[model samples]
Target: MIQSCLTIRGHLSKSLTTAKLINIRHAHSGIIDPLQLKPLQQEGGLLDKLISAIRRRSAPAVWKAYTDLKDSGKIKEVPIQYHSMTLQSFRLNENGYYSSDKLKFYKKCISDILVATKKAQYKLDVRDYNVLLRLYGQSRDWKAASDCWNEIKVKKNEESYNLYMQAAVQCKKYDEVFKIFNKMNNDGIQPDVTTYNTLIEANGRMGNVTEADKLFRDYFAPKNTENKSTSIISKYFIKDANLSTYTPSAAPLSRCIPPPNAVLSPTTDTFEALIDAHGRKKNTPGLNYIYKTMLPQYDIKPDLKIYNALIRWYCHSGDIEAARNTFVDMEASGIKPNVAVFNHLFRHEALKRNRPKVAEAIIDYMRKEYGIRPSTSMYATLIRIHNKHNREDEANRLHTIYKALKSKKLEEQ
Candidate 1:
């Protein structure tokens, strides 16, 4: 199943590349002289630079770029996109974690932006509100997200609902997720892949494995001739079968046929949610089935997150061999394992498995092979492990290294 899936996906990927090249050729068939183009305004150029900084996800860079543009005296008014992109820059760190200091800073930034928008008499549009919703969601500030939703109630679209649902999920307000989903249906908004992914994640995190499985099965693996009650005709569609549901605003599944341009397939995130659900329940067979059979069957390749989850599950289940094997497979598939992956394996080896040597070897391998610096906490763990094994010299050595690294980090900051 894995080979077949990879083969099919490779073919489709090549076809896409070919089509892109053809489109590029067609686009350049009539070359326009650069002299014929209108000169970009200084304000526009500054805005582009600010946007570039925002895309880099550097808070200081974003602020400097914005300040430069604002001080240039060419700006008539602040664009809503600037505010939105600025908010997006405060997203969680790469490890999917945030600090209180960051959240407080984000709140202050939002307050300043709101004041500026009011002074400029700029009305916040749905898109701006959606960005706010996303920012609040990432910060796990559900109340703030709710406020944004209320402000955009009249203009709430699919993205608005999806972001709000994500916020509720992040805050562990699982019940609110369902309520918002029901409201979305009643409001005639069709759920897209992101919406379904959030619902699945909410269900999975809440330990509603059955519901998560039902959603995946109904939406991604429906039988050809099966009659479903809850399907809608929209610009998006699911593969193999239509999404089966009976929302108040949706037509019968049997009667709804998608347009030719409609195509919605289960994404890598969809399977990640399922794997998480099974892992939460320790349903080994179910998790393996999703990773080995279902994902390949759907032509969805496993990403780094999926592999991380797999390793975590195996470690939690005391299957060290399996966890190590998954790591090997992840590397073989050309997915660069991140710090989280190494942390999982290292923790399991040093503490749970009581293989201090193996754990230290893993850390060394990570540093040498992937150039990943071990977190201070990992050093703490190693210190404890060495102490437990009556290796005071080793413990003291690691302690010195940890202190130096911590002090260096603080100084750099």
Candidate 2:
């Protein structure tokens, strides 16, 4: 009996040692970390092949490898990690700019994978559906997003609802937003702050000011009680804007005093949405209403986005002076300008071409001051502008510079 016990212990030790040796071999072969970039030469089995395919951003290759393994009886069930990595690869392929045809192809790839997982009864996580929902939203394919919503076997959470709401809103399906919200409430799920913000932004996007205001007043308004006196005006505004309540800044109104006794306060993003909504509709009065009344009550400072929105509205209004003043105010507030701000100025110059020198100067300032290398779109626009003005020489020179820059980038890669 003692000898048998000794033999069993020896065998267990041998199995562990073999595993260590195999891991060491894989490590030396440079396929140790799955998450890191695989070596130029990777040596492993089906999992290694799948990772390689994912790293290459070949959804077709990934799908084929997965199926081949499944058919060969090597992998009985698709691992959750495999699904996640594959989805991540799809997201990587998104690459910021995708044509409608490319988007359609990506959607099909995801749908096929989802169908396979469902057939195998492999439980899907919300993350998987969330990616698909976002893609559908981008593609404006609300029908597929709705179908995905029904495919979830597990109870949905706030994030799931948010994705669906965003998808509906992206497609301008305002009615669908309310429908999903109602379903969420019916399921006894409480809407988070994001849910209300999305609803407000969606309504504001459609110029449904009255509806947006009602939604805001219903959900985000401070809770009231019979014991204390509460005024409707006070809910959205401070009694007075005192200097003591202000944070000192060169810009106009750095911060305001928040209202008292508010349980759920609206965030800066909420007011940004409101401002954006009014801005889109050219309802300057509505923007003033939020800036002077609603924002002060919430103590939400106008951040870079708010300033950009104001600048954009003014630019669209052809009030370049107003836009310039807003840009100065943004700088005064100590918020450094981003590429968006510069792009707006560039776009204005592209359209007007009144002062091509001003556009060139702005580009210089962006490059020298902020170190913002102009994007390809910016160069293209400038070149087109020069061409429009019959400055073929200038256009050709800029085109040459752009090509050289692009070549440098590729060589670096």
Candidate 3:
């Protein structure tokens, strides 16, 4: 019996060894799998530098040796300062954004470098804001963004103001969003519908529904008989530009305005983002504020996005009934509910029976008011509930329900 077992083991080991040899040969022949190397666009940059360092900057002698430094001729064409900035700012994890682990490392490395060098103290420029805020937002470090703003706002520029708003939201800084908005206005930058919307949206994120609602009415509403800060927008956006700088042609951060009245007319896209963000943050009060203040004042009305934010927020808040109610409210207010709002309802708020009749009401509203079809997420949630309760039949039936929804969707298409 022992001899038979040894023979069998020997044969199995040989077979496995053969397979490994074949794989090695294939790799050497350049028949290697395509997935092994990431797509070309995703490669290059930081990884290239690391590879060079790992290879000791020595090539096969057939290929050119890799070097981190720029060639003399190439260096001549580029501006010295910008080039240094680009190199210094290059993350070792170029596009490590695709992988969460790598991104965390990338952020940590940058933070370490910043702290170790105390670079923030020496140079706090717009480009620096761009890099840091982008990193912070990507990591949802909103407070860091706000702290960065506190350091720079007194010497603030318009670009920093815009970025600070985004970073603040990522870090969940509702108050800073408004604070920066107010500061920007006091600086004489014109506030538009988008700006007002972001302010309201940030407040909503904290579930400060009342404060969000009140602030919107008082500051953002155009005809907001209540808003005391309507002029705050125009006043702050241009404040420093008008009084401090004499060179308006220079970027605001340059603080090099030629004369007063240096007005910056930001595009409508900024305002649209505010609207979308409000919907995301579920700041219903902010939405109302925008409806009253921006529609007539800036001629900006609520779009699908504004409604989507409220609905999605309600959905995420796990109030299926509230989500559905908002869906109805938006339609009544003349806005349409989109697929995202529907998806979020199932994803975030899908609780089952004995919880409340809220889920049913939302489903009913979606059917009756919008005529929009339910999605897989809703059915899946039902399946989850059924399984949790050990109701096999109900879970099986929920699968059938999903199948029916899928079929109907295909038919309509």
User: What are the per-residue Cα lDDT tens digits for candidate 2 across 1-413?
Assistant: 00010111111121234345344433442112334533322223676678678757676787777767666675544444355556545652222556677788887778776666656554555556667777887789888888888887766778789779888887988767767876776787777777777877876676555545555655567665321343222233322233122112211211111222444578876777676666666655565567667777777777887777777766665667767877887888798888778888877876665666678788889999889877677777788778888999999988998898788766864
Estimate, for each residue in 244-313, the C-alpha lDDT of model 1 and write its tens digit. Answer: 3333322232233132233458888888888787777666667667777778877888888899999888
Listed per model in order, the count of residue pairs whose N, CA or C atoms clash below 3 Å is 3, 0, 29
Tell me each candidate's TM-score. 0.73, 0.65, 0.42
Q: Residue 139 in candidate 3 has what lDDT?
A: 71
Model 3 TM-score on a 0 to 1 scale: 0.42
Note the Cα lDDT for every prediction shown: 0.67, 0.64, 0.47
- If both were scored by lDDT, which would come out higher, candidate 2 or candidate 3? 2
Q: Which stretches of candidate 3 lie over 4 Å from their true place?
A: 1-124, 146-155, 174-196, 205-304, 313-339, 352-383, 391-413
Most accurate candidate by TM-score:
1
Sort by TM-score, best first.
Answer: 1, 2, 3
Candidate 2 lDDT: 0.64
List model 3 lDDT by residue over 99-143, tens digit each: 355447546655544542343233433445555665666577766
At residue 252, candidate 2 shows an lDDT of 21
Better of 1 and 2 by lDDT: 1
